[model samples]
Target: MERVIGGSDRSAVGGRVPACPGPQAPGQGAVARSVTVRLDRRSLRGWHIRLLDQLGQRPDRRVRIAWVTQGSGLPGNAEVLFRLEAAIHGLPRPGLATAAEPVALAPYEARPDETVQTGDDIILDVSGAPAAPAAAPVWRLDFDGVPGEAGLLAALFARRAPVAALRGPDGAPVAVGRLGAESHTVMLAAFEDYLARTITLIAAALDGAGSPTLPDGAEAPLQPGRTFDLDGFGAGRRAAGGLARQVARRLYALCFQGPQWRVGWRQVVGPDLIDLRRHPEGGWNDLPDDGRRFYADPFAIARDGAVTLFVEEFDYRRGKGVISAVGFEAGGPRGRPEPVLELETHLSYPFVFEADGQAWMIPESHASGTIDLYRATAFPRGWVHEAVLVDGVVASDATLLQHNGRWWLFATVRTGGGSYSDTLHLWHAPHFRGPWTPHRRNPVLIDVGSARAAGPVVARGGALIRPVQDCRGGYGAALGLARILRLDEEGYAQRVETRLGPGAAWPGSRLHMLSAAGGLEFIDGSRPARPRLLR
Candidate 1:
C-alpha cells in the first residue's frame, strides 16, 4: 500500500502532534514563554491554522495569532490554479484545501512589542534584507525573494524557489529549505506537500534549534539566499500537459498495480559498489520470489561460516510488510524467503547486525511511532523485543553505526505533515539499547534526493560510507553512496560521491538498496508484476 504524509488533516479539529523537543540553551532549558505569531490577513491558508494550533499545543509556550493588514495576499491566479489542479488530479479536495478563510483568533491581551516603521508604505515589515544579521520582533514568510505570497505561485509552480522564514528587523533566515514534491504531475498534491514542509520549517525555527545553513544538496547546490523577480513562467501551458499525463497514469493503474519491487544478488571477488563506483559486470542474479509477495531492503550478515540475507517481504493480499530471511550457500539463495518476524504494524528495512555477540534487528516500525530493538533468541526466527531506542517519531530506514566509542542512529523522519523522506534526523547514545538523545540540530539535513538511508553504513579506509536513497525522482527511484566526512556530537555532515540507477545492467526503472556481507552483494529495484489470474 502507498504511504502518504501522516497527520495532514489534524488541523481540522485542532489535533495535536507530539511537540519537537527544542534544544536547551547553554544553561537554560525551554522555559514557558509567550509567543505571538504575525500573519497576513488576506492570504490565510490551512497551513497557517495548523501552525498556530501546533505552536499553541506546545507545553513550553503560550501561543497567540495576530493578523496584520499591511501585507500583500496570494497572487490573483493562485486560487484558479488550485481549483483547476484539484479537478484534474482528483486529490482529496476537503483535506487538501490550500486556501482558507479568516477564522476567529484566540483572545489574547496586547503586549508592548517595540516596532519600527518603514515610511508610510507598510510592506509587512518582519525582516528586511537578505544580508541583515539582527532579528526583528515579528516573523514573516518569503517566496521568490518577496514578502507575503506575491510570488508564491511563480515560485512553486514555475521557478521552484526555496522557502524561507525571516525574523523581523534583520530578516535573517532561521530556516531555509528547497522543497520537493512526490510527483510533479499532480500539481495539487505537490502544492499541499510544500505547505506541509513549510510549516515544519517554521516550527523548528521557533524552537531555537533552527538550522542556519541550507540543507545539503547531494547532486546539486541550493540557493536559498538568492533573490529573483516575481514574473510568470508559462504555468498555464505546463498545467495542460500535466493534466493529460495524470489522467493517463490513473487509467493505467486501473489495469495493473503501480510497481512491484524485487531483490537482486551477485557474488563479488573484490571490492563491491562501495569501492568500484560502478555496476559489476555480467549483471546480477535474481532472488526468486512467489507471485503473491515482493521483496526489498536486503540486509545480509555472515556469521558462523554461514551467510544469511534478510529482506522486507510485502504480500499483495495483506497490504503490509514483514521481515523474512533466506540463507545463501554455493553462491546462490537456498530457497524463497521465509517469514522470520511479524508485527501488528507494518515493518520494512530489516537492519540486521551483530551486537553484544548476538544477532539484533531494528526494523522500520515508524508506523507504531517507535524505533525498537529485537534480539534473536533462536537465531533468525525467535526474535524478542529488547528495548525501544527512540519513541514518538515516524522514522524510516533506521540505520545504526558505532563510531568513536559512541553509537549513532540515523533515519529520515516525517516532520509533522510532510513526505516520508526528505528530513534527516540524528540521535546518539552510549549503547545501542538504552536512552537516545536527539542531536542539538535535530534535522541535520533536508535534501530529498539524498536524505533517506538505503542500506548499512560500511567502513573502508578509515571513512564511513553510507548508502542513501535518491528520492528526487521518487521514493527509492535511485541509490547513492555518500562519504561521511564528519560525524560527532558537535555536528554531522556527508558528501555524496556516487549515484547509481537502473539501466542496461539492471533492467528496471528503480534501483534503491545496496548491501554486502561475506563476499556477497545484494540490491533491489522495481519492475512490472501482475496478479496470478492476469499472468
Candidate 2:
C-alpha cells in the first residue's frame, strides 16, 4: 500500500505519476504524486500538521503524503498523526507516490537561557524519546535534504514567510521570532538571531512573562503555496487575474512608485506631547530639497544655545545617502543644509547622542554589514569612525539611550531573509562604547507595524518612550509611540500608545521618523516625486 520513491524517479506508463484520491470536494482532480513524510517523534507537533495542510491547498500541483514515523511512540504521536491525515484529506487528490525521496521532518533544539550554534546536522534515532522538560518546546522543521545551516536557511528563504509554523504540544500556536536586517551577506547571523529569539518567545509565551507581538499583516493563515507579499502590492490578485494583469501591474509599479522621501518638522512645547495641528503656518515646514535628492530621519541637537538638525540626504542619482546638517534659530533655518558625512555605501537614520560631554552618531550602515559608531570631532561638521558596536549583521536605526546606570542600543536588524521593517533588536552595555551584550530576548519586537525604530528613545516622566515606524501598509507608512513596560537583561516588553499618520497637519502619503529636542519636533513624510526622463 505504501512505497518509498526517489525525488527524480517517475512513473513508467504515462511519464506522469498516478493520481490519488484527495480530501477535496467531489469532482476535483486527483493528486499528481505521493511523497513519504518522515516525522521525527521528538518534533512531532501541530506545526507539522499545519505545514502539510498548507501544502495541500495548492491548485497547480497536489502531493499525496505518506506518513512514516522515524522515532519511537511519544505521548502526542497519535493526535499529531490524526491531524496530519485530516490535513491531507482537506486537499485535492492526496495519494502515495511509488518512488520519491522521503521528506525528513526533524527537531531543532533551542534553549531559552542559552545560545544555539547552528553548524552541525543531526539525525533522529528510532529509539530516542522526546526532548527533556528543561529544553524549550520542540517544533518541527520540514526539509528535503540533509539538515544543516545551509539547508535550514534555504528552506526559510524559499518559504519567504515572515512567521514560521510552530506550535506547542498543547496544539496552541507559538510565537515565532525573526532576524530582520537590511543587508545581503549576513544570513547566517540572522539565523542565529532567530534561534535565540524564538527560544525567548517560546519561554515568554509559556510563562506569561511579557507581551509579545507578531508583525502586522502577518495574521493571515499560512497557505501552502502562497507567498508573503512584502508591500501588499496586490500581487496575488494580479496573478489570479491572468498574465496580462500581472504584466500591467509590474509596469505600473516600475513607473510610479520609485524610491522617494521628504522631510517635515514642527516646534513642540513639551517632552511628552507632540501636536501636529499647531504648526506656525497651520502646516508642516517642508525641508527644501532638490528633485534629485530627498531628506529623511531628521535629528536635532542643541549645543550652547544653538540647534543643529541632521538628516539623511538620499540622492536618487547615486542611489545612496549621506548625513547632512543645517542650523536652526528661533524663526527659521540659519542656512542651507550641507553634507557632513559621506560614505561609499548607503547610510540613513542619523541617530546622534551626547555622552561624556561629546557628540557621537551611529547612522545606519547596514550596507557594510555592521553597526559603526562615529564621534564628532568639530561640532556638527567633522565626524570620524570610532567603534563597531556589532558586526557581521545588517542593523538599522542604531538608536542609543542611557538609563538606569546602563546604556542601551536599539535597532531593526535583518537576521535572515524577510522584510527589513519588522525585527526590532536590542543590546546593552555599561558605557556608550565598549563590550555590548545582546538581550536574551534579542528581537524584542517583530510587528511590521511597530518593529522598525523610527527615532531616538526619550525618557519622560520616569518612563521611556520609543518611536516606531508602522509599515503594515508599506515602508514608513506611519509612526507609532510605544511606552516601555519592562526591559532587563532577561526580557523586554512595550505597549504602543499612539499612531500618527499623514493627513491634515502633514499633507503627504507617509509619516515615518520622529525626534524632539529643545522644544522642537522633527518628522518626515513621503510625497509623489516627479519622474525624470532620460534624453
Candidate 3:
C-alpha cells in the first residue's frame, strides 16, 4: 500500500487514514508511491514550481515523505519547502517485506529577532533577524540561501569540537539543506557557465555524492589570529554597486596594474639538495627582458656539460606567452635569451625532461584547451609537435614524474567554471608521450594553498618533494614545499612540509615558481610596477 500526506488539511488526500499501513503480502508487484506536492497556487514562484518538478521525477514507490505547511509567514518558508523536498529524495527505500515508516510533519515556530553567539565571526542574517544564542563556542553559519556557504558550514560543523546550530528567521532551529554559490558578469557566456556549476553543486549536495566542500577549500575557513573581513576588503561594496561602477573599476584595472612576473636564479655548490629555508638573501640574479615583455617559469637542463635554461616569455601587448631559452654557464647567461618555441596561444611552465634518449617539453597551453607534448629535434632550440596528451580540458602547470615504472602527470584543472587554482587532477601513462589515462580519483586534491603545480618533482632521501603555490592570500602569493606520501593509480596524497614567502630573503611581493637543475635553483616573483599613462 502507498500513501500521500499533504499539509494539515487532510482533505487534499481524502482525509486521514484509519490506520497506518503495515507490511505488504508476499508475491505482490513492486508498489511505487509518489507524493505530488502542491503549494498555494496563488503564491507559486519559479523556485517553487522547480521544486515540484524535481520531486515529481522520483522513481521509488516504497518511500514516504512528511508534508507540512505551517507558519506560512516564516522568513525561510520557501527555503524550508526546498529542503523538505531534498530530504524526501534522500530517504532510503522500503524493503519488499515491510512498508516504509511514516514520516512525521514538524511544525515551524516563528519568533522575534535575537542575536546568536558563535565561535567564528561570520554573521548570518536571515530575513534581517539576528536571533542566535550568545554562549556557544562553535562555528556558526547563518542559514541563508548562498552557494558554497552550506558546504563551508557543514565542514566546520563536522569538526564537532564546538556546538553548532542552524536557526530560521524567527529564531527557531532548522535542519541544514542543499546550498550553493555562483557569480558571473552580465555576459551570457559567463552566466551560462555559472548556472551550470551552480546546478551541479546543488544536486551533489542534496544527493550526498561528492566531497562536501568547495573546490578552493572554502571549507577550511581563515585561520585563527588572521582576520579577513569581506566587508572591509570592499568586495561586498563593489558587488552591491551599480553596473557602471563595476565596469569603470574593470577598465581602470585593465589600463593599469597589469601583472608583471620576473624570474630569479641562484647557484648551488654541491650535490646535496638545496635547503630552501637557508637560501641567501642577496646575490639573486634577475633574467633580462624588455619592459613590454616579462619572463617566468624558469626550467633548466644540463646535457653534455652544457646548461640551458627555458622560460615563458610573455608579451603584454599580444597577451600571449612563448617558450624561450638561453645558455647559462658558471657566472651568468652566455647570451641573450631567444625564443625557442612559439604558439598562437598563451603558454607557460616549460616542463622539460629526457625520456628514451629524447628531450621533451610539456608547456602549459591551457588556452588551447589541451595538454600538448613537444619533442626536441635539434637538442636545445629545434622543436616539433609530438602529440596531444590530453584534450578538451582547461589545465595548467602540468608536471610529470616517473615512479615504479609508470609516469604520472599532475596539473590543476578548472571544472564547470570553478577556480583554476584549487582542484588538482592526475593522469598516468606507461610511457611519457603516449596512451595516457586519468587517475581513478581524477581530482585527488582540492586545496587552494597546494593544488597548483609550481615546479618539478624531486626525490630527496626516498621522499618525493613537490613545490606548490599558495594562493589564499592571492595567486602566487607564496611557495610551499610538499612531500608526496602516496602516489599510485588508486589514489594520490601529499603533505606540505614548509612554506616560503617573499621577504628579506627574496625582496619581492610574490614568489610562485621553483625549479632546480645542474646545481642551480630558479624562482619567480612579482614586484609592483608603475604603469605608464598616455596623454
Candidate 4:
C-alpha cells in the first residue's frame, strides 16, 4: 500500500488511511491512522462500528466485546455500558475457550447502517469464497453470530482449508446469490473474519484516497470501573438466563424421581375418601381392590357393569419393565384382587373403554415406537392384540376421547427433549379405527400446566373434562382441570385452570393425582355396578 501524506491522494483507492487525526479536523470522527470509508460488499445484517474516539475513553488494553442487547426501549447510540469488577468478584469468564473479543476490520463498503458490537476482535481464519454480483470481486465475509451457523460454518472448518473455493453451477466464484454455508460454524467464523478484513482494506483505500497512516499511541483505558463479567454456564452474561437454568434443574429432580412414589400410599379403596378398607356392607375385601400400587390411569367406567383400571407397576429396583393389572368386584367381595394384563417388557398409560359392546385398550405404546390397540377377550384378564392403529410413531400417554363426533387422541410427543411433561400434540379421527389426522394447529396447546392429559373422561356434565398436571411451580406441581370448550372442524380449543392441589386433602401434599376419577357399578367382574377410579 503506497500513500502520499497530506495530499489529494489521501482519499484515493489502494491508499492507506489517514492516521486518526490528532486533536481534530472539523466534524469528521476518525482517530485511527488507517481506517477507510469504503469496504468490499458483503452481508448487511445488523452491522455497526463503535466510535471509541467519541466515547471519551482511550483504547487501553483491548476492546472488551460484550454482545449485550437492551432490556427495553430504543437505546440508539446509547452504549449499554457494563461494569465488570463489580459484576463478578473480579475478571469474569465464559464457558467458551477464548474470552477476548475477536479482532475485526471495519465494513462500510456494502452498507451504512452497520452497527458494530464493541470489541469483536478474535481473528480466526476461515475457508470461504464470497458470492455476489458478477463483477463483485470474489471474496470471503465474516459472519459473527447468525443462528444456523453452527451446522453450516462448522463443517467447512473441518475441511482443514483456510479458504473454501466453492463456485457456482457455471463454476464462477463471483455470481449473484451463490453463497451458502461453507460448512461449519468455526469455518464460517474464519471466513467472516477474512472477508471483514478484506472489506476494511478496500474501504480504507477508498476513504484515504491511497494515503493512510496508522495512529500513534491509540491504546488507552476505557470507562471507569468497567471490569470483566461472566454468565450462567460460566461467563456472566445476563441475570435472567442464570436463574432460568437453576429453575430447570430443580424441576427435573422433583417430578419423576420424587419421593412421592417411595412413600407407600395408604389409598382408602372403598366408596369415599375416608371409608378406608372397612364398611357396613363391605370389609377390606368387600370393596373392589386392585393390589397394584399406582393406577396407570384411573379406572374407566363401562356403560355396562364392569370397571377397567390400568395400573403402572414397575420394579425400578430390579429391572426397567414391570406392569400388570388387578380386578376387584364393583360391589361384591370388594377387596378380592386378580391380575389382568402383564405385558412382556414395559407398558403404561392404559386407556380402556367399552365402545359398541367391545372393550378396547391402548396403553402408552411409545416404548415399542408404535401405537397398538388391544381388545379385551374376557372381562378380567383376557386381551388380544386387536389392531395396529399407528406404527412407526412416537406417542405416549395416549388418551382417547370422543369429541365433536370424532375420536381425538392426546399425547406428549417425544419431540427432542427430556421434559416430556411440557409439550402436547393432538391427533383426531372420525372413527377410533383408522385415518388419524394431526391437529392443523398440532401443538395447539403449550403451558406446562395442561400439556399432558391427566386421563380422558366424559364429564358428568356431558362435556369432555381432561385432568392435567400443572408444572408451573414444578413438574406434577399441581393437578388441574381442562374442559374441552370447543372441538370441531374449525379446530380444538381448551382452557386449563387450577382446580385441586396438595392442600386439597390429607396425604395430598402435591399428590400423584387425577389420572381418572369417576363412579363404577359392578361386583368385581359381575353385577350391581357403580364403580369409579377415585384419584
Q: Pick the candidate with the highest TM-score.
A: 1
Q: What's the candidate order when arranged by decreasing TM-score?
A: 1, 3, 2, 4
Instruction: Look at candidate 1 and tell me the lDDT of residue 259.
Output: 49
Candidate 3 lDDT trough over 10 residues, lowest sum: 92-101
Most lDDT-accurate candidate = 1
Task: Output the TM-score of candidate 2.
Answer: 0.52
lDDT per residue (tens digit) for residues 375-395 in model 2: 999989789999999876767
**Comparing candidate 3 with candidate 4, which one achieves the higher lDDT?**
3
Per-residue C-alpha lDDT of model 1 across residues 370-425, encoded as one tens digit per residue: 89999999887999999989887878899999999999999998744566688999
* Clash number by candidate, in order: 3, 17, 12, 85
How many residue pairs in model 1 have overlapping backbones?
3
Q: Which of candidates 1 and 4 is the stronger one according to lDDT?
A: 1
lDDT of each: 0.66, 0.54, 0.54, 0.38
The C-alpha stretches of model 3 lying farther than 4 A from their native spots are 1-259, 270-274, 530-535
Error of 4 at 405 (Å): 2.2
Residues 365-449, candidate 4, lDDT per residue (tens digit)? 4646567888878764687887777665556678788866788878876542234566777778878886878788867776777
Per-residue alpha-carbon lDDT of candidate 3 for residues 331-407, written as tens digits (9 for 90 to 100):
87887678999976667889998888889999997656689999999988888999999987778899999999999
Model 1: residue 6 alpha-carbon error in angstroms? 17
Shift of residue 139 alpha carbon in model 4, Å: 39
**Model 3 superposed RMSD (Cα):** 19.3
Whole-model lDDT for model 1 versus the true structure? 0.66
Off by over 4 Å in 1: 1-258, 528-535
> Which window of 10 residues has the lowest lDDT sum in candidate 2?
92-101
